[model samples]
Target chain A: MSRVQAIELVYLFCAVCFIVALKGLSSPRSARLGNIIGAVGMTVAVGATFATPGLHRIGLIVVALVIGTAVGVPAARAVKMTAVPQMVAAFNGVGGGAAALVSLAEFDRGHASFGTAAAVLFSTLVGAVSFTGSAITFAKLQELMTGRPIVLPRQREINAALAVTALALVVWGLSDRSVTAAVLLALVAGVLGVLFVLPVGGADVPVVISLLNSFTGLAVAATGAALRTTLLIVAGTLVGASGTLLTRMMSQAMGRPLSSTLFGALTATASAAAAGPDDGADRSVRTGTVDDVAVLLAYAHRVVVVPGYGLAVAQAQHTIRELADLLESRGVEVVYGIHPVAGRMPGHMNVLLAEANVPYEQLREMDDVNPQFPLTDVVLVVGANDVVNPAARDSPGSPIYGMPILNVDEAKAVVFLKRSMRPGFAGIDNALLYDPKTTMLFGDAKDTLTSLVSAVKTA
Target chain B: MTETTLGLFTIFVLSVFVGFEVISKVSSVLHTPLMSGANAIHGVILIGSIVILGTGHGAVQGVLGFVAVVLATVNAVGGFVVTDRMLEMFKGRARK
Candidate 1:
């Protein structure tokens, strides 16, 4: 076969592999194989691209590959699971930056049809937005920037005006093929992306990150259209479609619509109202010792663990697992109640628990475990607040109202391991904390859990 | 639209459907890995960067292409490896 024909065939093969790889990833049992399949496909695609005839500058390609491997491998290998969301955001940002760079370089070569020009501009705009947006998300998750919504006055109006101006520049560049217009469009979109994400509260970041991931995919697909490559278009669209679906699912899990997440500032407004002196602090809370909590767990016939971002932050998954095992040894049944939006990202709590070797069957979704709470004997809520708030169901005036929660208050007794009475990421007080049956054990989650393990062991 | 653009559009639309169908069944427990895995797939843009760099373009384009190649490569490699590391942790009752 000719070189071009051979390259097309390899691309086709790689695309099929990617599809199968995604299919394999639908289940945990097959996910490892799926990852290997994707890696193999990438290797084949890269090798085929390298073999294309008339390809020169081998030294530069080798240098780039060496540098990338030298940096990428260690960064990936060294990242803790709790920071996986940040790592994903950082890697995605670089990918978006790369797409924008590729589009800029292609535009400079300047021999394009209207379709190619429009596609290049589209890629430039979307890629630039995704890059900056993902960077801000990384900063927020890494705690390099405050996770609170950084709202400037009249932010929405400014964002709209900027978007409109960028669109006009794209159209202008399309007609005149002006490089300056294209560059300006990208810069404006980058600023617009920052503005768009800045107003979203930290609790909504997973949804925003997922949306930005889709944007990067669409940007890559646009670059594919500009270059007339089927593989880039297919793979990019696959990620775009999947990422969008995942975003929708995550938002649904939180019981908030995607539109509200991006624009409503719901969490920010609610927390601001709750920040009053009469709010969280004025309420009475019952404090308990580790020995008390230990006795509560040991004597209970059944215990349910509700884990949240705090559990992940404190790196207490292993300690919690040890305590659970101690309980299980005494013939007290134990299961984990996982909120759909728990931790910083979807499925985050499950990953943390899995790292601690918690059985997959023991991790139950909110819907599955909500009805079981009333039958539960003792509910231990670790570093979770908003998801279990009774206000979601009882108080219409509460900000998280109408959002489905874990019904932790229904349990016979509730023990909360927390650092303080401060509100969760949503910045609203949880009525469940003051429930007559609830006892608060205020301290660092890991330290508290460690004490609980020893206490339970002695009991 | 030209035939080439039309063909591209067809591929894009079909790929979207394929993407939705393939990803629809993913369990909630695997959502993060599924996301990171899909994120890695888009790193295919590295091919476009490499193609650009191969043609021996102007100095400016060369510099731009090199950066693109490096960034895309980092994205592709880091994304896949990190995803693999996460999936490896998903082993069953045998692991513990």
Candidate 2:
């Protein structure tokens, strides 16, 4: 085959690899193999691009690749497990930035049809938004900024004005096909991106991150259209479609509509729960000791463990697993109730617990575990708040009213392992905390679970 | 260069459906890893960066292309490595 034909063949192979990679990743059996296949595809594609006829500045390109690997490899390696969400956001932001620059460079070269020019501007705008949006998301997750929704006065008008202005700039950039016009459009879009993400509550950040991932994919697809690269178009659209679907599914799992999550702040219905739970210092809660909790757990016929972000935050998944093992040894059945939003994102708890060597079969998803809670003798809630809040189902006027929750209140008794009575990521009050049947153990999750393990042994 | 926009548009549309169908049934437990893996796959934008760099003829475009190359490399390399690390725990004893 000719060189051009050979390159196209390799691109086709890379595309197939990506498809298989996704297919394998969705199942528990072949996730690692799928990732390896994707890497191989990436390596071959990069190598083939270097060999393309008429390629220039080979030395500089090699240097850039080396520098990128040097910076990226260490950061990915060193991040703690709990920080994986922010790390993913960091990588996503860079990808979006890259797509924008590629579109900008293509525009600067001054070779474009009107059709391609429009596509070029589209890529530049969306890519810039994705980059900045992902950066803000990273900041929120990393605690570099306040995770609560930040709404400025008259924010709705400002957001609308920005969108209209960005649209006008896109048209202006396309009419003349000037690089300066394209650059201006990118700047406006970047500001719009920050405002768009700033108002989303902390509980909804994962959905926004997924949406931004779709934006980057959309931007890359536009680059493909501008450059007439079929592979880029196909690959980019695949991610755009899948990312959009994933975002929808995640929001659904939380029982919140996707529109409300993204635009809720721009409208009047933003969660008033942003103030967080009211101070409950005057309200009495039955605080229990290790011995009391241990006796309760040991005597229970079936204990269900509910893990949330707190469990991940305190790095206590292993300790919790130890307590579960101790209970199981006494013929007390144990299962982990995993809320869909338990960690920072969907399926996040699975990763955290897997690291602690917890068995996969014992991890029960929300739907499966919800019906079983009534039969459960005791429900152990670890480092989680919003997912178990009864207001999600009972209080229609509550901020999280429509959201589905783990029916922990149905259990005979509830025990919470928490650091304090603070609100969860969504900053909403949980009425379940004050339920008379509920007992609170205020301390670090690891320390509490460690003490519970020892206490259960002596019980 | 000979291909029509209509043809490119067709591939893009078909790819979207295939994308939806491929991972539609993924269990919720694997959603985070699946999202990360998908994030890494789009790092294929690296190839687009390489192509742009090859087409760069001057200092400005060269530097633009260089930065694009570096950013895309971080995305592609960092994305895959992080995803691999996340999925690493799911093997060997993941099932038990």
Candidate 3:
């Protein structure tokens, strides 16, 4: 085969590697191996591209690659595990920006085939949106900006009108072959991307990040179509598919429709909470200390630990692991009950616990773990609230009603490690907190877990 | 439409199905890694940026190509590294 044919073969090889890599990533046993395979595929594809005969401005390309690696490697390496979501958002944003810029360059290279303008237009707009949208997501996740939803007056109507305007701009760009129109369209879409995510907050932020990741994938695919590059098309489409499926699964896990999740949902639920169940503060809770919780844990035949976002925010994974190990040493069976949306992103709790060296077999998914709650002698809830709240299934007026939650209340006894009496993400009271069988330990999770470990040893 | 466009379109459509099928059954345990891995895969746009830079000319091309290549590199490089970092903890613990 000719050199060009050889390169095409390599691209084909890279595509296959990607498919296998994705397959490896989703299953527990092969996830790490899958990631390594993916990196190899990327290296091979990049190496082949660099070797493309007559590649020009070699110095500049080398410099750009060097600069990017310098910036990207350290940030990825040095980032705290709790901050991986934002780091992913950061990388995703730059990818979108690059795709947008590449397509724009292609358009100016006189490849603005008026016939293929739609494809070009699509890649550019979506790419720009992904870039800007991912930026805001990064900021929110990083706490560089507020995590609360920033709703404007009639944001729905205004965003709808902007959508119409953006569509019109796409039509204009296509018909006139106007780079000017295309550039303008990108600007409007960038604003739309920002406005799009600004009104989504709380647990919804992670879902928005997943959706924007999908947007980036689609943008890259459109870039592929615009440039007629099969590698771009295939790789981009694959990511688009992964992100779309992840977003859907995350929404399903949360038991909310994708649309409402994005557009500042739970307003009705918020109002419902406001109207009546304002009794969380007044009702007395059965508060306890480290010794009480430790004794409860030390003797239990089976204990299930339900970790929440608060456990992550407090960086208490290691502490929790220590506590679990201590319990298991005494012949108690300890397993974690992980809610699907537990740690800001889908499957996040698993990663956090893995960092603490908790074995995957012991980290049970919601469905498999939920049923075991009743058989559990003690349910130790660490920095978690809503996921264990019986109100989701029992209280219709509750904001989180109908949402799937862990059956923590079914255990013979429940112990809560909380920072305060504050309601959970849905902003409603947890009736479970006041249940006669439940006991609350008010403190930071890590500190409380530390105390529990010592208390258990003594008790 | 050109035969080339039609063929590419065919590839694109088939890919969508393949993509969905590959990831649909993934347990929630690997969601983060799958996403991080896929995020890195899309970084293959680095190839597109490079080709554009190698052939295109002028001030506009230079500026756009430079930025595009850099951003794509970060996306690809950072994406893969972070994913590996996440997987490292998983592997390290599992081994012992």
Candidate 4:
């Protein structure tokens, strides 16, 4: 077979592998295998491309590969899971940027018809935005920048001007005879990227990630079109579509408008932080120990566990599952209240819980499990904070106001596992901790839960 | 590098980085949010497909464009619905 045909076949294989890998990733049991399959497919695809013509400049290819491998290998080996988001952000941004670079380079090499020009402009816009936006996201995740919203006065006006200018640049680039305009537009887009992401509070990270993923996919499709490659078109389109859907889902989960998130409205300003104690009607000053939490759970008919970022930090899902198992042994009903936006990603809590061997049926969504909280003997909150905070419902001035929170605060008794009084990603204090019936178990979630499990096992 | 080579490089690099994510267990607190956030980035597919449709000209392109638009819309709608359902969990309180 000709090299072109071989490359096409490789692309087909890569596409198939991506599909399989994605399917595998849908469940925890097969996620590892899925990742491996995807990797293999990608490897095959790359090998096939090497067979393509013009790409036979062996020296350049070898050097690029060596440099990429050298930089990529150690970075991958060293990053922590907590830093995973930043890594994902940086890598995803690079993918979009690469696609944009390919499209630009190809445009420079000839594909500059009016239609192609528009496509290039659009792709560049999307890719540039994704690249810089994701970089900011990485910084936030890395704690290089505070995850709190950074809203300036008259922020909307500034955003509006940036959007208008970017659009104008695109129109100008499409009509003008110069490439300089496109370069200028790219710079504007980079600035817009930082501006867009900086104001979004940490709570909206899932939406941001999804949005960036969409950009990467879209950029790839554009790259495909620029290269006149049908497979790139298909693969890129699929990824873009899936990514878009995921973003909308994340936005809905958070009950925030997509436009606002993109435009930077989620930031909690200094004024809002200072007004915390004025709204005291539903204030909770509650506190408790593992023994106190145990007593409440021992006689209770049903207990629901709400796991959050805290649980992920404590690496305590297994222990939490063990505690739940013990509770089940004592005839206490156990269910998990999984918030869709519970962790940094969609279905994050589910993945973690499933890893710990938590039963699928017992793990309920927020809607399915919210009503059951009233009858719950105890609500065990493991390593979660903002997700369960009452401020979302009770305080309008609160940073998390209007955002839905887990209903654990409404439980007959609430037990919180925390390291200290530190705020959540939004960097705001939780009022639920101070509630009368609430108890704080201050320690590592895993260790504390282990202790609680042993106490219950012996009791 | 060939397109195929680049694709392979992407996969290996991503997997190694992704693997580190699973092992380092750093910033465990952000995992849930990060996952959801990453999931959201998947929406680029919608935007990508839409732009492709926008560029199509012939009858074949028209059909492809229509398909892309439909798929993108469905993705956007379905994703939001699932997300909303998840958010409701954080509402209200229970009296024990």
Candidate 5:
């Protein structure tokens, strides 16, 4: 067999492995296996390339591998779970950047088809944008920068100009004097990337990251096309396709179009919380003991549990599930209310719950559960803040103005599990705390839920 | 330069780079926001692909451009859609 063909075969295996890895990642239980499968495939592909003809400079490659491992493994191992999304974004961006760089190198070495060069140019521009943008995104997510939406003065106009400039540079590159034009295009694209992300609110990072991951994959595919590498093409396409699908699912959960959010959403006018807690209408915030909450649940005919980031932080999913089971045994109906943007990423709550063996069917989206709130004898909110806050509906000037929220307040009795009365990710106080029907059971979520579960049994 | 070898070399080089990024978490902090922010790059891909389609290229090129446009659109629209939904969270309280 020709050496190139053999190498191709190895790449095909790697591509297959990437597909498997992606499939594994679809479910949390198999995500680790998926990662391993992808790694093994990549190893095989690399090994096969070593056997290719004219690859005599193997020493540099070996050194590169050694150095990469020395740096990568320890760094990945040391990252905290909260930083997982940031790590993924950076890695994805680098993948895109590397692909772009490789294609650029290939273009510079020789051969010129406007088509191929254009492809490479597009890839490089996007890849660089991804690299820098992801870096900034990581910073914001890590709280290195304020997680608030940073709106530069005249951001829209500046971004529009950058976009136009990038486009002009690309066209100029395609027509003549490609190198300088390409470099200019790259810079413009980089600036555009920064502007595009800077104005976005921090709450959207998960969806944004997933979307960018897809961008990186597509850039890699473009680079693959530039080089005519079948494996890179296939691997890139798989990632691109899967990432797009996931992003779509995430968008639908929020009941809005992605475009609306992209162009400086009107959310600030609509969904913000109640202004100043001293409005005095519902001044008396309800407070309760774990035992009181357990008693209320024990006697309730129906209970809906809403889990949020606090639940993830407290690692209370297992206990919450146990509490659900205990309620179910007494013939009380139970379900989980999952907000679209709960926790750090899309489906973050789902992932945690699934890990705790919570039944998938028990979880309901905001729209589905909102209607049922009035009939619910009890709505037990565990670590949820802004999504359920009534301020979105009542407070006109609040940051989260006009956004739809779960009707947790509609329930006959509402129980909140919280550490304190801190506002949610948006940093606004919720009026739900002071509702007449509401009761706050303050403590660590896991410990609180466990005690609530035990208290329910005796009640 | 009909250097097919160069293309092959690029693949290996890129693979190494990909492996490096995946293994190293030095830039872990940049992942999510970067991912979100970088998504606009897909629009560039979309625009480029559309431009190619409109330029009356070869049949093969046109077909390829069309596919790229489709894929790029999916990424662009899908990315924005998901991001918008997530952004909704900041507007209101996070419901449980």
Candidate 6:
């Protein structure tokens, strides 16, 4: 048995494990097993790589591994579920930076066949872009920067020019075999990456994060091509394809096009400012007390609870669960309506609710729950805004007019629990708040829900 | 294209189809975990980084390789662990 053959066999085994892992992830029942399988596959791949003949610098490798584990494990374990999206963004960024560094090192080793040069350039460009882009996304999600789209004068033209220059640099480097040009290419691409994500609004951050995840995958695949490793190629391409699909699905759930999400600054900012009460002072809104909302929930025959990013921010999932249980105890039906793009990421609301031991069966997707709103007695919207906005359907002038939203407006009565009269992340006021039958219960979500739970118990 | 490049391309193409097929079946409720899991899979680039670190020649290459190894390792480790933590919560929900 030759050493090279042994390594190939190990790679083949690792690849199969990854495939099975992904297959298991398609269902909730098998997701845990899928994770375990993937971890095992990664361990095997790393072990096999360690055994490659002539591999030296073992001590440094071990040191790096130790340091990484020390930082990575704790960061992963300690992160609150509310920050999972940002954590994912940060991790994805590091992966991309690592891919670019690998290519840089490879290029320094003097292996510059035209084909390899192209591969290295592609890897460096995409990797650098993904790294900077994901970092910006992480900052945005963490609220270190304003989540509003930050549009500069002539942003599109600048981005186009930067992209063109980066490409030109790549070509020049490839022809001249100059490492300096390659490094410059990476630097310019990094700038392009930052520019690409800076103008995306908070509401669109999830989709952008998913798209950047795909970018990291493509970068890794390019690294694989440069290294001539089939396993990396297979794994990277799988992630690339899946991440792209996920991004598409998220945008579709919002009923927005990808191009618009990447470039909707003009409309987004304008609509945000226009949708506020200051601009629409003529619009009338009705406010209610927590006691009133509790009575409404207690008397309802069937209630649908809509959760959103504000719900996560308030950490109100457990309190909301208690309130729902109290309602269910009084012979009221309670079901949760989950928007696909709710919270800060896709399926974010589900993770939060699941943490509170909410029944999986009671959590309904937007498509399934939208039709049931008419039959619903009270639609309790907890800390959500845009997803329930009627403007998505009724107001053509609204920026989110074409986006899909929860049909809470179709219910018999709607009760919104909000912090204030502020618009949602889209910076657009929700017409549903001013509907004749709507009642606004204003306060911090957890505090409001806590009061509601007790009120339901005593009522 | 050379035979090696062609082989890589073939793998890339086939993997795309497989990824789409496998991921399309995932329910919307698990999309977060799906994204996180896929994030970890791309951490396979750690192998490339480690290879560079082990075989790198000069001090500059060594430093670059070392940083790459560290970053890629964190990506792979953190991604898998966090995903597993998330999936564990889902599993708990399913059992009840």
A1-459, model 2: which lDDT tens digit per residue? Answer: 899889989989988988888888876668889989988988988998987889988888999999999988899899898798888888888888888999899888896888788888999999999999999999999889988778887887897898888888878887878888889889988998899899887767888988888888889889988888877888788889888888887676444679978876666444553455343422346577776678678767789999999898999988999999888887788999998888899998999999999998999989999999999989999999999999889999888998999999999999999999999988997778887678888999999999999977865
TM-score for the A-chain in each candidate structure:
0.64, 0.65, 0.64, 0.61, 0.62, 0.64
Query: How much is B76 displaced in model 5, in angstroms?
Result: 24
Off by over 4 Å in 6: A266-459
Q: Per-prediction DockQ scores? A: 0.54, 0.53, 0.56, 0.04, 0.04, 0.53
Model 3: per-residue lDDT, tens digit, A1-459?
A: 888778989999999998889888876568788888888998999888887878899888889999989999999999998899889988999999888888888887664776468877898899999999999998888888977667776777888898998999998988887888888888998999899888676556777777888888898898988878888889999989878999987665454678877863324345432343244322446676576577567666789999988899999999999989988787788999999987677787888999999988889989999889879988988877877788889988877889899998889999899999999876888878877578888889998888899987864
Winner on lDDT (1 vs 5): 1
Worst 10 residues of 2 chain A by lDDT: A273-282
Best by lDDT: 1
Tens digits of per-residue lDDT for model 1 on A1-459? 898999999999999988988888876667879877987888899899998789888889879978887888899999999899889988899999999989988999998789889989999999999999999999999999988667776666787799899979988999998888889999998998898888776767878888988999999999999888899999999989989999987676455678977876533465652354345423556676676577667656789999999999999999999999889887788999999998889999989999999999889999899999989989999999999988889999988899988998989999999999999998998877776578888999999999999977754
Candidate 6 or 5, higher DockQ:
6
- Model 3 misplaced regions, further than 4 Å: A265-459
Clashing pairs in 3: none
Kindly report which residue pairs in candidate 6 clash with one another.
none
* TM-score, predicted candidate 6 vs. hidden true structure: 0.70
- After superposition, the stretches of candidate 5 with alpha carbons farther than 4 Å from their true spots are A254-256, A265-459, B1-96
> Relative to the unseen true structure, what is the C-alpha lDDT of residue B55 in candidate 6, on a scale of 0 to 100?
81
| Model 3 lDDT, residue B8, Cα | 91
Candidate 6 per-residue lDDT, tens place, A1-459, comes to: 999789989998988888888877766667879978988999999999998788899899989988988999999999998899889999999999998899888888885888889988998999999999999999999999988677777777888899899989998989988889889988998998899899887767888888988889998988888888888888888888888998887665455678888876644555662353344422446566565576567766789999999899999999999988888877788999999988889999999999999999899999999999999989999889999998888899999998999999999999888999999999997878877578878889999899888876654
* Candidate 1: Cα lDDT at A253: 48
Ranked candidates, highest DockQ first: 3, 1, 6, 2, 5, 4
What is candidate 4's lDDT per residue for A1-459, written digit by digit as tens? 887787777777766665565544443334445555655654565456555664333443444445544544455446554554555566567656655554554454453766567767777778788889988888887788888767767777887898999889888878873466666777788888888888766656657876787677767666665555645565566556555655655564344567756653434345653343334422534345455466456556788998988899888988988888888877778899998888788899999999999999999988888887878878888777888878898998998898877788768878788888788888998867776577677888889998888766644
After TM-score superposition, the amount by which residue A430's alpha carbon in candidate 6 deviates from its true location, in angstroms, is: 9.3
| Cα lDDT over the full model 3 | 0.83
